[model samples]
Target: MRSLLVAVCLVLALHCGEAAVSCNTVAEDLYPCVSYVAQGGYVPATCCTGIRALNTQAQTAVDRQSVCRCIKSAIGGLSLTPNNINNALSLPAKCGVNLPYRISPSTNCDSIN
Candidate 1:
């Protein structure tokens, strides 16, 4: 019985690890862009790199919604000004990513699909 329990636990761990990336992962990926988005200036190449990676990673509807929620939450925590929000919204175009939905704190993630 102990061996069976151990096997079950191992399987569950593996399954959880294989699950889709979390909102925190998305937030981490976008963390580097905060400065650029917060200030009015040329966005660094590294910022674009992270944005593109986020676009590619969030391909599915669920993933997109997760990303949206993460972006909203992450930006809210940043204490950026209104201009920062505008600059952040322009990232997709600047980075050449065609995001399916707007990146805003008020966005409804459930309506992404």
Candidate 2:
């Protein structure tokens, strides 16, 4: 029984979803696909799809800036390095936080910081 359970767990882990990556994971994982696109300096179909997913997912989040920052930091570390993607991205130009996108700290998040 123990061996059967272990085998089943291994199979499940190995055969997980092969579908396109989601933004949440991308945000969490720095959207490795986007990093690949950014590194390539060209937005391919996969990157566009991921971008759309990112925008849609951002709409669902209450704190969008933090998420963007998380994604930015992740993508910045990628070989392509984060550049211009933020400017062209669907993320707001400014948020309460003083994100890398903005020049100064936002008055909106002054209290939180």
Candidate 3:
């Protein structure tokens, strides 16, 4: 019984690990862009790198939605103005990432796919 319980636990853990893109990962990937987004100037190469990386990482519909939600949530937590938000949204295109949807707190993650 103990062995069975251990197996179940392991399986559950593995399943949870594969659930979706983590918010922490999302935050880390976008960290370099915060300065560029908040302020105005030439966008950093590192920022573009992070944006491209995130675009590559979020492949599936579920993964995209997960990333979308994470981005939206993070945006809410920040004190960016409309110009800042515009900068953030424009980062993807500037970085050569063709995001399917806009990155705004108001975006509906459910319709990402």
Candidate 4:
């Protein structure tokens, strides 16, 4: 569906060199959170699962920076409100995933590593 398209686009768009994790994988993992991030409803178990999976995969500094860039790109593509942006930023915490850097478009992905 839409997620698949997003994944494909992300894979083609992200040119952050090679990493264990792909942008397509990143999009897939975070796709489930879109609803909760946009609408601010009950957090879905599937979303949290994806969040945890992403956290586990992004172990190295390079991987983490790639993930951060992917997230920022994804968020930039979305027409989210300020509240929705807040939700997206807080999503990892809600899902029990403590990311080293904040997931905002303003985040400096290059500085992560």
Candidate 5:
């Protein structure tokens, strides 16, 4: 009984951890792209790396929606210009992620899935 309980707890913990996506993690991964996206400059290597990581990490529909929400919130908090928004929207294609939904302030995250 004790071993069964321990095994169940371990499985639950792992499942919960895998299902969680933190906003801070998304922000940190996307931070490197700010300058390039906001200034219309070349996409940096670090930004590509972060984009790929995010693409890989957000495999599920739920994860993708979470990422969209986090990105939308982050962009809202920033003072990015129109050019910046355009560049940022283009990052997924630039990085070859082929995201299903567009990344914009008005993107309905509920429709991402």
Candidate 6:
């Protein structure tokens, strides 16, 4: 719950060029879809598709608290840091999205942007 909120808040804030996008939405939205994958269950393509939609809106993200919250809710027990931030941002991009990274938190994602 906290993770989801954090991720959303970050993405929402970044839309104005302050935040950076995290792939929490991709993980959150996809993790529950094929619970029985090991049992031979199949995940719908749309799950990733939806993640892509969300990513489109977050290209200029801010890396806010909400994104961290969303990541917490999505990853369960993982930690947050600048290292994995790129990976988290890359998830939805695999599905076909811009998903750019910003240079600084003080800046609106990109220094020039």
- The C-alpha RMSD in Å for every predicted model, in order, reads 11.6, 12.6, 11.3, 3.2, 12.3, 8.8
Minimum summed lDDT over a 10-residue window in model 5 is located at: 8-17
lDDT of 1: 0.66
CA deviation > 4 Å runs, candidate 1: 1-19
Please give the ranking of all candidate structures by lDDT, highest first, separated by commas: 4, 3, 5, 1, 6, 2
The residue pairs in collision within model 5 are: none
Candidate 6 C-alpha lDDT tens digits along 4-113? 44554454333332245445443455443222221223435664565555555443334433343344444333343553444444444445545343212322322222
- Report the lDDT tens digits of candidate 1 across residue range 1-113: 24423332343233321216565466556656756665658887877887888778877888887777666655544455688778888888998988888867667877986
**Residue 10 miss distance in model 6 (angstroms):** 18
Cα lDDT of model 6 overall? Answer: 0.41
* Candidate 4: regions farther than 4 A off: 1-17
Number of colliding residue pairs in model 4? 0
RMSD of 3: 11.3
| Off by more than 4 A, model 3 | 1-18
Q: Poorest 10 consecutive residues of model 6 by lDDT?
A: 102-111
Candidate 4, residues 37-94, lDDT tens digits: the string is: 7678788998899889988998899998888877777676655678878888888889
Stretches of candidate 2 off by over 4 Å are 1-24, 27-42, 60-63, 76-113
Query: Per-prediction TM-score, please?
Result: 0.75, 0.37, 0.78, 0.82, 0.77, 0.34
Instruction: State in Å the error of residue 112, model 4.
Output: 1.3
Q: Write the per-residue lDDT of candidate 2 for residues 23-113, one digit (tens) a residue.
A: 3444433232433333344444554554455445544333344444434343333333244344334233221122333311222322222
lDDT of 3 by residue, 12-96 (tens): 2333223266666666677777677767688889878877887888889888887787777666655567997898788888888
The TM-score of candidate 2 is: 0.37
lDDT winner among the candidates? 4
> Could you tell me how far off, in angstroms, the CA of residue 112 lies in candidate 5 after the best superposition?
1.0
